[model samples]
Target: MANELTEYQQNLVSLVQSHELGDIIKPLIKEIHLFDSYISGTSHLKDRSVLEKIAVGDMLSLQREDNKFDSNAILILNEDGKKLGYVPEKDNIIFARLLDAGKLLKAKISSITQKGSFIQVGVGIYLVDL
Candidate 1:
């Protein structure tokens, strides 16, 4: 099979290749949510004080849990390896399977929000070039 780049990937490549010296280019991969933390049951138990300190671009770690209700459950962690929450059920299966299949997926803190009783933490998953 021939390899192909998605439209989005092609655009990013063009943007990068056309850059001149001193050009200020933003990250090629913008922040995207692989999961929503607000809907997670353990999200509330996280230390808001700590979560608030998490900033964009901060690297995150994912841990696979086989015993969780969702067999594909993936736990998200902070830099210090503290459990922040989990990858929401909606997107957990695919992500977990990818990890299990030996894919090198990197995650980062994309955005964090606190509104009323909801604490939303969005993670950005980066697909590394093989």
Candidate 2:
């Protein structure tokens, strides 16, 4: 592939509002110093040519809360702002890992009678199984 997005990158692109690409990618593309890093292509080499450049790109119009997890994994909450599930390191989003591995892949609703719902998260993948 001349340029391919990783599963996580793909999920990110998927999450992006196609109507507004700049608004979506500018925020979560991952930043380092002033230059923001995006998965230009799926090639893992750290080269600038194939890499998309944004030394000073537009920041997120909406401020996204920065939560740093030392483990590099993070739990994504549901719509109600409740813990739903986690995304592993390297941003691997596989159905097998989320479903077959018996991982802490799914978060349960705290109360049976609650109107809230569970969110499914695996890296960039957000599957609404519940």
Candidate 3:
């Protein structure tokens, strides 16, 4: 059989691909309970990192490398989806900074602090002063 999809299937794919949040659902963000998301035309499923386990409804952003594959400097937001801190991967990321553009984070709040509020997410102690 040919690898094909009907127009309806295509439209469904588009809807899922675009991840447009509707009144009853949300976009496919990392916080979704399921981390089995897959990229089109590839077997690259979203990595089931410890980060992907964040509670549902939590807002998250990713940090990319050259606006592509995983890199560093990725940040995570609070439950309210506010910029709380960066991922850092495993080390300090000095460049390739892009928010709401190329950043894609996969972490969660490991701990909390005051001042403003920080998190032990993606990489680790990303503190953000209020």
Q: What are the TM-scores, per candidate, against the unseen true structure?
A: 0.61, 0.21, 0.27
Better of 1 and 2 by TM-score: 1
lDDT of 1 by residue, 74-102 (tens): 77777788777777788777776656655
lDDT for 117 in candidate 2 is: 36
lDDT of 3 by residue, 12-130 (tens): 32254355443234333223232322111111223323333454434444333232445444444445444444343444343223233223224333332222322232223222111
- Alpha carbon deviation, residue 62, candidate 1 (Å): 1.3
Choose 2 or 3, whichever is better by TM-score: 3
For residue 59, model 3's alpha carbon misses the true position, in angstroms, by 5.9
Clashing pairs in 2: 87-123
Q: Model 3: which residue pairs collide?
A: 61-105, 62-103, 62-104, 62-105, 63-104, 116-130
Candidate 2 residue lDDT tens string, 36-76: 11221123233323212212221211101224642234443
Rank ordering of all candidates by lDDT, starting from the highest: 1, 3, 2
In terms of lDDT, model 2 sits at 0.30
Q: Cα-based RMSD of the predictions, in order?
A: 8.6, 18.2, 14.5
TM-score of structure candidate 3: 0.27
Error of 3 at 126 (Å): 17
